[model samples]
Target: MAELKEIVSTLDAELDIKSFGKDSSFSRFIPRVYEPLKFDWQTAFEKDFVELFNGLMLKGNSTVGKVFLAVFPTDKVLERFIEESNSGDLLFMHHPLLMECGDPKGKWGQGFVPIKEKYIKQMKEKNLSVYTCHIPLDCHKQLGTNIAMAKKLNAQILVDDTLNAKNEYVLYCNIEKTNTANLISVLENIFEIPYVDFEGKKLEDIQRIAIVAGCGDVVDWMKEAEENGVQAYITGEIHCHIDNDYGKQKYNQIMEYASNTSMSLIGVSHSASEYLVHKTLMKDLFEKNFNVETVLIPQEKWWL
Candidate 1:
């Protein structure tokens, strides 16, 4: 068993962690978070990004021997692990510690600037190394967003309409050729969520399907399913628009109408549908001989 730092170093050499992104805000800081978990298994992050991301891809890599789970308030969370584990290991995370969208050159151009700054600043101080895989991890066929969830529900895949290979997708899956109510029941049972909006007129013909994680912004992807006769749609969240004529109430009414017209929409909270992506990933990692741990971040916000 190696110390926390040693394991990080090994992963650094292997994954080229140093080259993940230098100019990005987190480039200089994230490594500090991974240092402490090398030898100490007990000191790792529990529910945050590290645990979530590691859960998804831990099985694919044969080179990684072990991993320490660490949940850090800041980057300094590395201190907890370094005291426990040994070398030849590393840390992986969900929820990007550093992601900048828009303009990388402009101020606040980095994706999620404020959150990145707060976390990365602490990481730099702790001398820890961290890595995160968001969409890519979610879209892996063997261990992807739709595949994992679909398997649990015994859902038959209709299509994997991913615009990009980076986990951007609208996955269509069918439930044992059931009615809308039965399909909804199956989804609730499979995901353990209590409710979803089912607007399909005839559930009996609902043998085909479509679903996606994250904000369902890809209208084209959703449309493709409708074009192909997908009766039900599942997604992480919903989109609402309001105008003077179409207030919040009106907007929702229109949305309901929309749902009733074409495909039924099942709005599963983004994290709820995607949680297995990490949990199952972690299971695979543990099964693959890499000592791994998980941390789940609490949902700070919720829809009213």
Candidate 2:
């Protein structure tokens, strides 16, 4: 068994949680009927895991016998965790709130909805702990979401923070000579997804690639990748397809850029892209350091 405090401290320092800025995506868009906590997001994140609202969201028990890692605290996933786990188990996720990152094949998501009050009560009653890490995990060198994808693909890193100070979160890699079709096949297998949203020219020769794990429709990132001689760009969502003016504008810009640019855009899905970190590296970290059995609660439907 590992003490919850110890795990939090070790992870906080190792991941350098405080280095990254502005993870407060939840501050503005909280659920209309949010269960008013004794302490709000600002107060809750005062001491440790202080990326506004990133770490140790709830304290159920002092020590944890097992750890459940998830990409998001979706209602279904949380229900499963509560059912399967002991009172003292921990739920370590990438996000505390349920981020509705629209289904690739279906409609757009509701976006950053807070957990229901009943679920919060159930967790408190069951003595289940909740911990969240967002940006830090995304940008970490060895265990980051992007690096995990690069490692799984076996791509040689051409430009990153370790080798070049220029690139941090997004990785520019050199893959062994392969075409877009073969690379897509490899990615589908790696992330265990049915389809990947791909844009741009499907060429036969793809030497260099850019990888951004989640919500990778940023036109600037693609522009930079093009400038750096990247042939393909891999991300979770090439087009968020959100049902809003901003979303439409962003989508159109990304489509335009991808249409014009030579680099291919591949979206693996937001949840699956980030899930790799927890499944492999993050799982290893908990098992190795805490010596506790870790349960990875995956999103039921990657498309959703």
Candidate 3:
């Protein structure tokens, strides 16, 4: 077993969390709600993230016997982790709270939801730790969300994080030329999804594409990708189906841009988009290097 600080620090150093200057809206709405308890997990977050944003949110035990990997700490995921994992086990996830970005086919969902207070109390009692790395995971080279997707497609990364730190979350890849229809089929198989939510061109010579794993619904990023001359853009959520004000606005804006652009827009679902890194990169980081046992908790219904 490795010390929790060693594991947390290793992640901090590897991802260079401080340098990213990233922010999260995970705890934005309910600051007052969790403020009363003054939990260390709420306070131990890096100060740069406004004191409750990223890195090790909790320090449950001195040593970590096993590490649980997941995209987010959803209710079901946490419940399962608590039930299966032992004391001193660490939970390393991409998001601190569950980003219920919604299932286009099923009941739509509201945005970020905090872990149930009961679960939080239970974890504390169990001496379980929680560490979340969002953009850092997205921005990593071999271990990043976008890179894993590119690797899964057997595509070559033309421009990676080192080349464009400004747009580190985005990736430019070169793939065997294929039409949009076939490319969607390939994505469906890779992500193990029934269907892909897509729009735009069905071009045959789609040798190059841009990837932004989680949410590619940003217009500015889409414009940047368009400027790069890629024939397609692949991401988790093309138009976020989150049932909220910002969600509605973003979906509208992105849909408008995609309608006019010549590039293909592929939405493989947000959680599915980020899941690969856990299987490919994160699994290796803990099991092979850290010499710790790992248990991955896949999202039960990634779409919602």
Candidate 4:
């Protein structure tokens, strides 16, 4: 247990949470829409504000035998993990527990999802601890999702000047002149995704790139890329839900912006883009720094 706390402390120190600021402003609006579901947003902010959604969600035992890492804690994944884990095992994930929050109409809201109560009960029964590191992991300079992805593409990572509302850094890279098709092929191979979505000019016109791994669908990031002279932008998801009117509008706007600006866009599955942070960066960090046994379980691709 002492070692586990030490490990968490070390991670907190290494990430420098104090410098990142405490306000969980992103999640603040969630409670207003629906009662804070699985985890209390306000309490989390009040207790450990410096770390942005980074802490032990469920306190288990004092000692941990092994650590299991994943991008999200889906019910099946969590159940399987708990079944295979011993009493003192720990589950470290990027996203938090999925919670079902509804609006006045009783329909599910945009950000909230259904909570898996059975999974939580199972974890408690098995005495398993659940730890999550969302923005902090994404903001880490050396092992962040964007940096890891940039390194895998073999692009010359220039600097981390791009900033998001959460104060996270987006990586800018200069890749040897590569066409859009070839770049898409490379990304597909790297992420093991079958297909990718591209928007904007001809495939051959892509050169300089900007990378923001998981949720790069933000318009501000796109504008920043354009302002920084980025010829191509790569991101996880592109918000193309045909059934959703708002999503369709956002998608069309992004496509139009890319076309008008002559900038290219490539998007892959969100899980695939961020999985490398667990499989490569966290694995290496834990094994090298703490000499701990770590197992990385990739989130199953839900695209079928």
Candidate 5:
């Protein structure tokens, strides 16, 4: 087995994508994080497992030799996973099968309810390796949704947090001299989003702005952006309560919070944010081995 660093180096070379950068969303991947994360590739998989799990890790110094297509499942989809395979073969799913967020100090507060006995037992028996990419995939520099959207719109990076090890948000510029009406028309034509709201009259010097993939319920952050002189905050969704309670608007409603401070909110289904990752990852894998095939899980739910 190749050393972990070697594997990472291989991935870097093959993907041609930078996953870490300074001033990242949360400064997500710091040196301290590197210390605790392990890169053991020694786990063995069933003979057939290699067809199932290898190639998912884009570039590695050593060959994992195990790869496969994983079907994505939703909470209600409830397709029983083939758990009893082999350990160390990582299962990279698009959705988190075991995720909940809160203080783990209490049982109720713990994130991610464990799967039922039938599923857990099956996984333990098969020794299948399971993992989910979720936001990480959506935010990946090369395969992420933000980059794809930017490409579709001919947008430029105003603040590129794509490479941040912490891997948080991506802020890209759409149009500088374009009028708001034109910008809105362009966005509506290109994306699955239905509408965009304007806070004030069309904006000038509108070339500068920030965008989040889905849901901007993080109101305080937008407020902070306003203080920083940001012309607009574009996102998929924001809390509707902000309208009646604070802004008196509908859930998808876009608001002009203050003069000289405005935002454009674009609401698309969450799946639209990361659907491109499947194809992007496939391309990376193909560079390493052309015969290898990649597939997107069928369970991802969204339109367009």
Candidate 6:
């Protein structure tokens, strides 16, 4: 069995965690924002992973026989991990267990829904450890969500920058002559999604594109694409909830902006697009460097 700390250290080295900027405003908005401990590099490294997730170590420690990767922490995914893994296995994900802190105004919790006590108990019994990497994974040069999506689409990179002050990469690229319908088909195949949501422009009008994977429907990012002469903006999820009238109105406004600018917006499922990083890029990373068995446990599709 490989020591869990060793594997985490290897990943940290590969991801260059030390170079991550902790002072940004976006960093503060993350689930668990922490002040750096005044310690040597080794001590800091020991505390970094735990502190990053606000000391949420669901269960287990030290030695790990296997590693399972997923885009988010869900009961189904965790159950699968428990079934597939022996004692002392690690579940590494992009999102934390508590996606949002309890807010009565928020849609999910409605007040406060604590992490399911049963799941925590199950994980502890099964000796499962959970770790999360959010913005860091999204910003990684090679394995980042946006970079992976751009590579999968075979687009020529025009601009690569931290997108819209979110500390996540947003890429602008030029695709070889292809219509919007064909482009959507290509994306569906690549991400293994049933359908895509789109608005603005004709199929024949798209060439230059901007991609920001996983909840990249921010107006600033879209504006950036338009400013950079991008004819298409490809992302995972837009705020177009059918029941929420305000959400629909906001989406319509974005569509109107796109129409005015002669731009097209194409949205794939958030989980599917981000899953590319774990299934393709990170799988290779683990296979190349570690002896432990690594598996990709894809998150369930939210849409039919």
Give the deviation of candidate 5 from the true structure as CA RMSD: 10.3
- Write candidate 5's Cα lDDT for 167-278 as tens digits: 2563546445665667677766655445543344456456655566644545555665554455555554433322133334332333434333465434433444444444
| Whole-model lDDT, model 3 | 0.81
For 226-289, candidate 1 gives per-residue lDDT tens digits of 7767787776554432123423443356365565457776655455566555556545644453
Q: What is the C-alpha local distance difference test score of each model?
A: 0.47, 0.81, 0.81, 0.67, 0.42, 0.66
TM-score between model 6 and native: 0.79
* Model 5, C-alpha of 187: deviation from truth (Å): 5.3
Q: TM per model?
A: 0.56, 0.91, 0.90, 0.82, 0.50, 0.79
In angstroms, the error of model 5 at 176 is 6.7
Ranking, TM-score, top scorer first: 2, 3, 4, 6, 1, 5
- Lowest lDDT block of 10, candidate 1: 100-109
Worst 10-residue stretch by lDDT in candidate 3?
A: 40-49
Can you give the lDDT of residue 224 in candidate 3? 83
Query: Which has the greatest TM-score?
Result: 2
- Candidate achieving higher lDDT, 2 or 5: 2
Tell me the number of clashing residue pairs for each predicted model.
52, 0, 0, 3, 36, 0
TM-score of predicted structure 3: 0.90
* Model 4: lDDT of residue 237: 64
| 10 residues in a row with least lDDT, candidate 6 | 103-112
After superposing candidate 2 on the true structure, give the runs of residues whose Cα lies further than 4 Å from its correct spot: 21-24, 27-51, 160-167
> Over the stretch 134-212, how does candidate 3's per-residue lDDT look in tens digits?
8777878768888889889998888444343246677888899899999999998888888877878778889988998
**Residue 120 error, candidate 2, Å:** 1.3
Model 4 gets an lDDT of 0.67
Please report the TM-score between candidate 2 and the true structure. 0.91
What is the Å distance of residue 300 in model 6 from its true position? 2.2
